[model samples]
Target chain A: MAMAAFRREGRRLLLSPVSYNSSFAARSAILSYSELGPMGARSISTQAVRNRMKSVKNIQKITKAMKMVAASKLRSVQVRTENSRGFWQPFTALLGDNPSVDVKKNVIVTITSDKGLCGGINSTSVRVSKALYKLTSGPEKETKYVVLGEKGKVQLARDSKNSIEMNITELQKNPLNYTQVSVLADDILKNVEYDALRIIYNKYQSVVSFLPTVSTILSPETVEKESEAGGKLGILDSYEIEGGDTKAEVLQNLAEFQFSCVLFNASLENACSEMGARMSAMDSSSRNAGEMLDRLTLTYNRTRQASITTELIEIISGASALTGFSQSARATDNIQYRRYACMIKLQS
Target chain B: MASTAAAVPFWRAAGMTYISYSNICASLVRGCLKEPHRSEAVAREKVHFTVSKWADGKPEKPSVRSDSPEE
Candidate 1:
């Protein structure tokens, strides 16, 4: 312990020209140690060093606790998001194959969580919707809006002078309905004002990533073309008729039902995509917070170690000067110079 | 050696009408089977399916033609 203090004092004295007196005193204490003078004073300084170390350990404990909490929340949110994926894959495939859906004067329905802290999940969607709106040419009358979540409604309402056609903030708690979805579809279908319909939402890409997507609900003519083309997929193969009026009625209903099926399928898929996106965004943010906490703990430990070394050198040098030192001042100065060079190299 | 070849009936191997009509029936069968329980009803012959044509300013007419002399 005395040698460690002597080495530390030699560095300090060489580095700071103003602290020469302190270094001279430390050398004197080392020389006096042989004479067995003032050993009791050195014991008090060692106890103070132990106390400093204990405080540093406490800080490390707090940072580790925060990392654990963030990780736990990430897990639950990821499960909620991933469970809804069963319905998304086939839906997206259907959408991709039928690409003729026009969207010149269509309505966009967006969903976002009401609560924040999922980190940028809500804001990124809002920004994407705003950019989509800006990309439109022609008058505002050409565009219609439907907002699915509270956050989306509030965000769109800020820029929109006209009221939204449908705002479904209550949907988070309740189960979705064909009635509500069909009613919305019927209302849009009634008005031939729009060339096509589109929905904007986030598509979950992974546990920690989501991409903004714009899905098209094709126009009536294009839907007919798709159904006709889909007939090539031979999905409609088992209808048998007894050669009567019952067959006629069934065919008429089948034609209408086919169109409605496509609309319902698209909407269901859009909803699943939104939930998945939310899960991924939250998971990534939780991971990032954990990494930040680790770096902070490391920095806190290093700064603490430096402060302890400084204090030890001060006490050792003060004690050495009080005793009658036999070591020459010239020899102490040479040792001090070499020590400062080593410390400077370590710091750099 | 080939004094005469056996004569086949018009609707038999000598003609193509049967094959073409059967292909249309096959297509119709394929088109209606995708619905849930509709496949069983289709197999039972309880439902009749037809395609109709509507010309300009005309009401409707059956798109298929029959070769029966009685019709």
Candidate 2:
């Protein structure tokens, strides 16, 4: 037991100064380790924040430019739509009063944009079509589709692939005009046959909203019936008939014009709606980017400050340790001189 | 086609195009067509009306004897 006690004392005697010195070294090592941790994190966060900010800024630039372009385009479309009302309004009144039918045969013309990122304009049309499908479609009824843009074509084809009769795309390559509508009308006339025609498009509400609207156009059968009645109670019968154009013939031309007119006006309205939707959508995305930028900047600043504070503490502690080492070395020399004095006394 | 061009206001197609001009003829045809209730619009091209005269103030009556403009 005594020998064991002696070994323990010997070990303590040999390690006492080193153990006392090691406490300071351990404290300095902890400070240095902590300093490196925040130092690395701050650098990585700084670079990441810079890259994220740059990309978001670029996206914001693109969306802002899109908003401006959409605004300008909306103005032009609005003008054309307003000016054409003279031809379309009265013509609509004459034909609008057609008798409703159980509608065994119906054709739906869905209008959307060739591009995306404009919000739910395209899906809204498709969803409206689904609602209308219950009214006009059944085992007894046949419904056909004419799609005006790629987005619509893709979405509708998912549900009604076989019903899509005409899929038109690449229209945004040029601004829409009356001739295209007319030609499009003529094409529908020659290729497809239908009893009733319905056009669904995004109706422009404002710079912030658009709603999908359904408008019914005069079909050949309805026009034939309306002309026979001659403006209900023969209001149009008073006009002196001077033309070689038969009543049916006049209506044939009018029907063609009417189709093109509705298509043209709807195209104008939809184009405006598309721009409005895009503008608003872009506006929000830019705002979101701005918010993200603000958050990242805050995180970056806090991390940098923490790293700086850690470094300052490290520098002060390291300077004090260097001074303590010098003082301790002088004290060790003083102790050794005292030991030598003790030996001289023993010899005496 | 040339005669139809002069009779309709083909010049209306030039100035106001941000998209395309191909549909100008369609617009002219739409414009010239008669509106049943108006006075000035009645003076313009009337698609569903009798051709009273051409834009040149010459006649295009299609009766048995008045087939030609000179008649």
Task: State which docking tier applies to candidate 2.
Answer: incorrect
Model 1 chain A poorest 10 in a row by lDDT = A41-50
Candidate 1 residues lying further than 4 Å off, grouped into runs, are A1-105, A117-141, A161-163, A174-195, A204-212, A218-283, A325-348, B1-71
Model 2: per-residue Cα lDDT over A203-222, one tens digit each: 77777778788877665556
Interface RMSD of each: 21.9, 19.8
The sequence of per-residue lDDT tens digits that candidate 1 reaches over residues B18-52 is 22323345446645777875664333222111222
User: Model 1 TM-score?
Assistant: 0.43
Displacement of residue A124 (Cα, Å) in model 2 is: 1.3
TM for every model, in the order presented, reads: 0.43, 0.65
Tens-place lDDT per residue, model 1, A1-348, is 775567566556545643543453465445455544464343212223334445545554554454454456445544544554443345444434333343456566565655444556666666866666666535644656656555666676676636355444443232333333343333334433444455666665554566776655544344444556664323432435554334323332332233234334443443444444444444454455556555554444343334333444454455456432443254355545655664565456
